[model samples]
Target: MINLDGALYPWRFRLVIAVLLGMVGVIAWRIVDLHVFDHDFLKAHGDARSVRHIPIPAHRGLITDRNGEPLAVSTPVITLWGNPKELMRQRQQWPALAAALGQDAEVLSRRLQQNAGREFLYLARGLTPEQGDAVLAHKIPGVYSLEEFRRFYPAGEVTAHMVGFTDIDDQGREGVELAFEQWLAGVPGQREVLKDRRGRLIKDVGVARNAKPGRELALSIDLRLQYLAHRELRNALVENKAKAGSLVILDVQTGEVLAMVNHPTYNPNNKRNLQPQAMRNRALIDVFEPGSTVKPISMLAALQSGRWQPTDTVEVYPHSLRIGRFTIRDVSRGGGPVLDLAGILIRSSNVGISKIAFDIGGESIYRVMQQVGLGQDTGLGFPGEQVGNLPNHRKWPQAETATLSYGYGLSVTAMQLVHAYATIANNGRMVPLSLARVDQPANSTQVVPEEVAKTVQGMLQQVVEAPGGAHRAQVPGYHVAGKSGTARKTSAGSKGYQQNAYRSLFAGFGPASAPRLAAVVVIDEPGGEGYYGGLVSAPVFSKVMAGALRLMNIAPDNLPPPLPEQQQAGALPGNGGRG
Candidate 1:
């Protein structure tokens, strides 16, 4: 007011310019943050309003036999999902959607009304191909169809216990499926599909991410052998009227599982009809006291210890062995004055074998058993495999050693017993057992001397040829070495054995010259006139062995060519050299 001039005017203008500059700088900094530094946070603002997400499922893989025969496969399936939040906003329109989808309106209304805040919820899984098409045709705002896979068992119950089944979500749930889930399940992929404001599909933006299918699996089971074994086991169970039965055939040279069969089986595809026990894999999971089949193992120990020879004679008491408070006895009295070691096997004399065990003592026998992979897992990659019970020497009572000597006090699974016998058949070499074949290197440990194994193998042969033994186990064209077992099922609380309840077993291998396959058949509670292993299990061995031999096309050793009718006349006499 006192001095008005041009300089004062310019200074006042400069202050106003400075204030305007500060406001512009603040706005520019905020613009940089929102558009550049915090761009993702700003973009998230539009997610709820403009973006739509969908799930993509990966394809499950196929499980096949070594020869490419399908065991497990996946068929095309569809799943229905809904966004509850979107559906609830149009609750009144649910009836229209329900009618178009051919579902009950009341049910759809209830599902849509449940917790309006839910973003994703499954409506139905594993829909039939036709039903899936109908759901897609509806084109409802919240409902969608996703392509998926469903497990199918082509071999049905024949391969169920080995291949196993998947859960509803196509995840491995049991058997090989669960055991090799990492290898069997594929990696899932994702895609982004743009939608308009009205929820109508628009053009694709870019390339889609493809899912990787699961890796294919090849198993060691042979289809022909598996079928034959299953058929025989089912018929045998019905004929014997037994509670249950199981059989396994192993390649003694390769340790590959040729066949595995269990009775009271259920179709994995039709799981609704399955019973609790029908699903059990008895061959690998269940353990029982293997009566006389265990005799061969003890014989190996005895021979290895040089305490007994194949022909060495030992007098067997007619009835029972009184050891402390317990007594071991034979089913029937042996007919000879004194039984040789070979005679003891032929007659299955419990008393004589127990004496052999007594000579070898508990320590040597236990060491051999452990070395041959008893009282432990078989490492076959089976689920729920039991490690059989073998009481320690320190825990054994005065009578335990004698009873165990005759295969009473110890327990073993069918696979374990088979492997032990296969070790003997392989000339004392312990091959790592395999269910699936690969190029893995072989590892072996000597369980017994080669001489000892040969001696035991020879003695086991007489069990099938001699009288009062398992003659039915003998194949006409093939020489066989095997042992029969019959053990009474022990009762609870140590009250002694149960009457008429027995586990009958026949374990053997054939061609005797060069052992090939070792097989075992276990029949539980065969309530019939003949409850012995010779009667119940030997015939199964014959059938399985004959089939296995024929399947492999192995020529029988030392067999002459068939003679013509005219040439047959000279073959019956000492003129047999004339052919």
Candidate 2:
């Protein structure tokens, strides 16, 4: 401490070291904070400049037949969308964009001006991938292409009535498309994507939310049978020069609608200039008085009432049945004075059916009809299905009851008629009708006595077997039991019957010994050589059934009997009449 100007104190040395070390420590701490503590925050800010959330398209569910044949498919497509605000700033590119989209430049300008306030607007929808790629190649600002799917029907017009069609935006419009819209429309998702300064996608970062594809729907239809039905129905329509027609085939065991088709149908893919009425699924929605087709059900009622036996004979006055102010007449003549129930149905005598109906009372017949699904909705929930009309039988007078017995007062869709027949074919047990493939048979209800049903079914077999009574409906190698009806259509206002307006119908099942399939065919306004159900509709039924039974490998129940007296024994087994 003696020479203060020349000597340094220990405190001063310690202070100098402290200042240097503190400076280094502060620098090291700042480096650690920047590299570790604040790393995530700074990185997020850096990404915000180029990161984006993009949409991931969800495809619609596939529609297939029971055999996994694709009926409706979702095809990959691209949609062009844009941010109007951003697009408006690049007005110079409008002409190029319009030319790419095949639109007028002037029109595009007006549309853009009207939509400048909107953040998003669609330029084109359902464009081909090539078209979208071409548009994107131009690299127009604010214009973006989004991947999407369009519903395409492979079966086209053949399965149009069942599959239906969708709108341009992929929204369901009619048929199964509309009925199961909720189940078929999937949820779209989002994903994080990296983009360049020019708004071009660079990389997929990660899925923000995974897309959920729609569940696949397998319908109960068999495409093979559908084609068969369509071909046969179309032939009938063209051959008979009929206005329209419908045909339905149902599996008796499972109550499955194997095939259903309608005429004057529109292609699902091409709906331009499509008539609204052409889209109607006539088989399910169109209602007609079943005509003579219900005659068997009437006999079923009579048997159930214990008032008449199928073998019991009724005194007949041909074309001579008068009920109150109305006179019920049969179109046939030259019959025996006394006719049994079998003969009555064979000739389709309105008088005989009416007498049986009146004796048993309309209430009895109504009970049977009601149990057989008349005026009831099939649980299939098909779009545009009509419940049809079934008035209270107790309110019917004698004339009304008689007409009801012969299938006039009540109405039935082709689907309902087939259901009733299928029930009887299933041994009087009613099962739920299904349009979807079912793993198990639905619960059955005894709508009519099994014995009554069997007896009536046998009587129908005899009628079909009888000469000149739906003989045309016989399927080669199969024993068919069915009824034919030629009814004069009522006037539009229900005022009275119209002339030259007939609905020819045939409804029956094959392999009568052991029923497996039931079908119904209705030909409207047949303007050909013959218009009777047996002539017009029966031939179509026979062709379709023959092909269907053979296709299904159903065993031949009616092997042609050896010719009586060996007359024309040379005739083919399937072509020769019953011996």
Candidate 3:
């Protein structure tokens, strides 16, 4: 205080204060630049590093039976993916990563090399949440997981051919899955997510679009009936040692397919069992000569021609008829008995039916077959459905007409055959087949006069009920109406029919008086000593029909009146004859 002014220079004090103020000004300007001018640029760069737009996987549609039972569905799963560029840098950790993923280290290395240029690579798909979490627990950098969906088939091989299957990407690849892929697929959404520098997800910021799930599909098949058909058909196929087979059950009233199954099926859930031969939907895809199953239709045609009546007569006692260079023979050896029109169908007389076809003219038979929907698509919209070969002969030859009477020289699918039988069951009206559930009664068209259809039903009932009939086709509590057809398959690399290989078939409906269901069973190349339709295919029809009649609550038209003396003596009715 005595000499303060003399102790310091004025310019030096001013310079100290000025220097401190300049530093503060410089810092304030820097804050302004960072907060205002460069704020958006820095924020964008930071977002590029830590904020990521991730896809939200959508779920596929469901497939259900007529009763809303889930046949096919999708479950949420985790898909492991990685940035090859970033993952390759952590080569030392590859063994651990592969171990966690249950993949070989060498394989992982090759995969990385294969996708070196790819920014993202799929490590695994359709992994269960547990599996994904176990791998994620390792916290391997650049390895991330995204949500996905995997298809699960609950009915397995029982409904495999009909419900079909999907691929790893949830893409429908077979059967109904392929038929309705568009309707079964969903739309994926996007969301912004925050991640750490190691690429681990931190938090979801906001959703851009919510995922839209696929729509559900309902099929016409009842799971209960489908199960019954599958069990019976599978058992029969295994017992017969057949190469392949198909069985189709139709709701005669509604024309809806209740159950359609194939042999040598594959479980859709298991990818290892996939084979073209096993996955084929034989009922709709494969065709064969219908054999004597067409006898009812031939009689229908004969009666419709007005040239013949149910009371007409033909001499089939001789068991053989010479027509041109071909000879038509019956299995009946005991001769000299004339049969009426109904008797011809009951015994499945080739000679008698051929006479009717020849007298009525072959064109008439062909025309009636056309009206019955033979050689045509069944309108099921099934993938790979075959339009069978029904040659329209402008002029009918005697030999061809004889073969036609016995169900040869033409090919038909099981679906088409059942569709015809359903027409008769539905009172001569051809029912429109449906694979999906329907809300209304089938829109049917009268393919024949209702009276003719009823008459044929009565005659077909005789084929199962009468003595020397297809007695194996008779059910315990129902008046089964059907026919057994045994036809020799054509020899491979040759023209004539094979002696051993046969296509055994049975087709008809149950509760003959007021039929509720129509079905067809075809056993291709059955093994062992039993190859006749009555012995092989008719039994399947009986068991399946019996169950279906009970399940549908249809009143039995004929309950047996206790065991007969022959049945009690272990001599089943008509158990020894050819179909």
TM-score of 3: 0.86
lDDT of 2 by residue, 329-387 (tens): 88775457777888888888888888998899888888888899877888878887999
**Model 1 regions lying over 4 Å from their true place:** 1-23, 29-53, 89-105, 196-203, 395-398, 439-441, 492-495, 558-579
Top model number, lDDT = 3
Off by over 4 Å in 2: 1-52, 193-204, 393-395, 561-579
RMSD of 3: 10.1
Q: Model 2 — TM-score against the truth?
A: 0.86
Worst 10 residues of 1 by lDDT: 198-207
Regions more than 4 Å wrong, model 3:
1-53, 193-203, 333-336, 492-494, 560-579
Q: Which ten residues in a row have the lowest lDDT in candidate 2?
A: 1-10
Give the TM-score comparing model 1 with the true structure, all chains together: 0.89
lDDT of 2: 0.87
How many backbone overlaps does candidate 1 show? 0
Candidate 3, 1-579: lDDT as tens digits: 376653467887788889999999999988898789978877899999999988888898899999999999999899999999888798899999999999999999999989987879999988999999999999887898888999999999999999999998889888999888889899999999998986777988999889998899999999999999999998998999998889999989898899999998998998784788998999989888999999888888988988888887997767889976778898754324788988888878898899888898888888888889999877778889999988778788899998987899999999999999998887799888999898898667898999898999999998898888889988887887998999889877888888788999999898888888999999999996799999999999999999989998888767656787777666665676575
Cα lDDT for residue 275, candidate 3: 85
